[model samples]
Target: MTLLADRHGRTFPYLRLSLTEACNYRCSYCLPDGWRADGGPRFLDADEVRRLVSAFAGLGMWKIRLTGGEPSLRKDLTAIIATVAATPGVRKIALTTNGCRLSRHLPRWRAAGLTALNVSLDSLDRERFRAITGRDRHDDVLAGVDQALAMGFDAVKLNAVLLRGINDDELPRWLDWLRDRPLALRFIELMRTGDNGEYFERHHLGADVIEDRLRAAGWTPCPRAPDAGPAREYSHPDYAGRIGLIAPYSKDFCVGCNRLRVTARGDLRLCLFGDFGVPLRPLLREDGQRDELMQRIRALLGHKAAGHFLHEGKTGITPHLASVGG
Candidate 1:
């Protein structure tokens, strides 16, 4: 199989697939204005998703991550996960969720060959959690985290968006929480995206500040495991797990980007901050012409930019994070 490489010679082996634009919680940073809980946007059906995964896997892609405004909202998520996991070239199948509904489905997903999970938990305080997620589901999320750890998946990660004057002060608390667990806690910097310019200006906190705080608390830098993603991992001498930072603005983490994003509607985003993408839903619905579909996908990969333009003054893309699959 031919590898999917762009003009800059970076090969993409990972795919972030958005299952739907619908979400239950209205996170302050993700969906500050609130969103429709009942109906918002439609998504590709299980079969269509399977076909796309097969096509990507045929091109040497091995990792597949199912993302969404909230992936757990989908009724057929387990079937989707099973389909992708059964695909020949796919080696890992993971999901990123708010974790509100993950507890009930953990066993089924694990049995279906799920390799990892990334749960979103922004704060440890109950009131502060409600303030951040715009919902009082902190206990539900924590329950899901407990379930994930109890199940013993290959890897389970917790993602937190760091905002100044918000959950930023809870960094030490988060580290303390991670001290006993085997999970990896990652703090992500806020990106100035689409309609979030004002929000970003008010809340964005650099990862450097988070690192200094960790250093002061006695956390030591450590080498990242070979299979690790974008998070710059660190550890403490006394802790059982590690802490990570994902600083997209203060640092250029795109030097070796090897992933592509496909929205639920089938638009392939080569770069997270770029507006250009190629629509593949219509093409996938065509007659059984797998070779032709593969050719088009390869051609599109060539157009991916060497790096995003966020560092050069571009605020963000036109689509919001919810629609863009986070």
Candidate 2:
């Protein structure tokens, strides 16, 4: 099978599928005022998701990540995982969740072919966590992290969006806390996408400063870990796991971006920071149109932007991170 390569020759083998636009947390950076999925198509059923996954896998997609406002909020997540796992070309299945409802579903999800996890955790302090996420489930999220580590998932990554004056002071504490763990801690730079331009301007902290702090504090850069994603990984000589920095703002991390995002509403987003997407629900709903659907998908892939223009001060690509399956 031919790989899904864009005009820039970037072969997209990974797919990020948004299961739902609904989330329980009102993260200040992601969704400050909270979100409600009262109207429109709220979510795709397990079978619909399975068909879509199969279609992408058939196009030589190897890795699949289930994302959402909070993927764990979906009751049929395991079923979706099972279906994706059963697809022929899908080599790995991963999840990105807020971890609020992860503890109860970890084992089942693992058994259903969840090979890895990326839990969103911004702050370690209980009150600070509550303040950041607008929810008081910090301990619960930590418990989910602990459970994931205990369960020995192949790759358990912690994703923290570093914001100035919000969770920046906890960088040292974050490094110390993960010293004895086998999970990877990624500190993401704030991006000015969606409706958070003002919020980003106020709190955006670049990864350069964070790296400088780490280096000044004696965190040596170890050999790079094996991964295809965007994190620039590092480690302390005495630490068990590694530290990563995803600086999309201060630095361009999209040179080799090989992925596509499918929103919960079935829009095929060729570029995360692009303003346009192809509506895929209509094709998916039409039976006996897999061939045509695949063709349309391939054609859209050709239109993938060379790179996100956010570094050039482009905005309005997306309204919110939740809508873009962040």
Candidate 3:
């Protein structure tokens, strides 16, 4: 019962837990322009989350990632980290944030057993940053990066979602910025999700373009041991860690995808591109339903698709990425 293999025969050992669906910045790639403030989400209670992590660990999952509209926004983040760290089989605990709130939580987070950090940053220019994230905190994010490194976080990844007309031309510049730094620079393909579909059509740049630009900039693709996710990692000939191109949209990583997600509200999602998800909260709340839920999870994984159809013009979740924990 601890190990559940998917239809593709891949067993998932990682789980992405979305702490909340709330966010401060209305990024062009996530939320659209003229978005309303609809704060009507049922976030999982802290205790419930603890129980879920414990159960997942009992089920053979060892790597856990706390993500969100902004996971750093969760009030009990440190407590959640501590609880998951105590889980039996759990080996890795990480968080992905927009970098707007990372610096403030670095010291405390590291002390609580959180191991890795992935920061979302699109552009380096002040005006462009503001235009992209609908905020003027580019400097704040940069400082946050410095603060995270100074605090000794194991790995600090800078996530850049590349859009074609928007920031594609700045690829080399971004690479140069991280050339001397040890942090991993991840370039995410502009995914078709949320209200930001407009940018998908305008800013979608495949990994090939990114790779070509990196080579033209005199950077070599340092080979990496195979990794999970869509990003094909490459590094400067002499750079420390490496840069990764996550082409989730342009090039789906579903074939080797061995990860599943449980939304803050308790929905079990098999794939990021899949539309339907079974609600696990009801089962988790009932002891008698525990076995039933596990069976459902197994069945779901058995039906998992080989990969997502991102290149076939699929935009937005049948339920939107925000609802699906993108």
TM-score each candidate: 0.94, 0.94, 0.90
State the C-alpha lDDT per candidate.
0.83, 0.83, 0.75
Against the hidden true structure, what lDDT does model 2 obtain? 0.83
Record all residue pairs in model 1 with backbone atoms less than 3 Å apart, i.e. clashing.
none
Error of 3 at 171 (Å): 2.5
* Candidate 1 wrongly placed segments (more than 4 Å): 37-41, 216-218, 225-227, 313-318
Tens digit of per-residue lDDT, candidate 1, span 75-96: 8898899999999999889899
The candidate with the higher lDDT, 1 or 3, is 1
Q: How do the residues 270-292 of candidate 2 rate in per-residue lDDT, one tens digit apiece?
A: 87788787888887774577787
| Model 3 agreement with the true structure over 1-326: per-residue lDDT tens digits | 44667656777788999888777877877764523436765688877787777767767788888888788778889998988888888888888888887667788889999888888888888898899889889988999988888777767888888877777778657656776788888888777764556656776777778787777766665553322445677766666657788877543466667678998888887778775777778766644554566566767677677877667765425434555457
Per-candidate clash tally? 0, 0, 4
Q: Which scores better on TM-score, 1 or 3?
A: 1
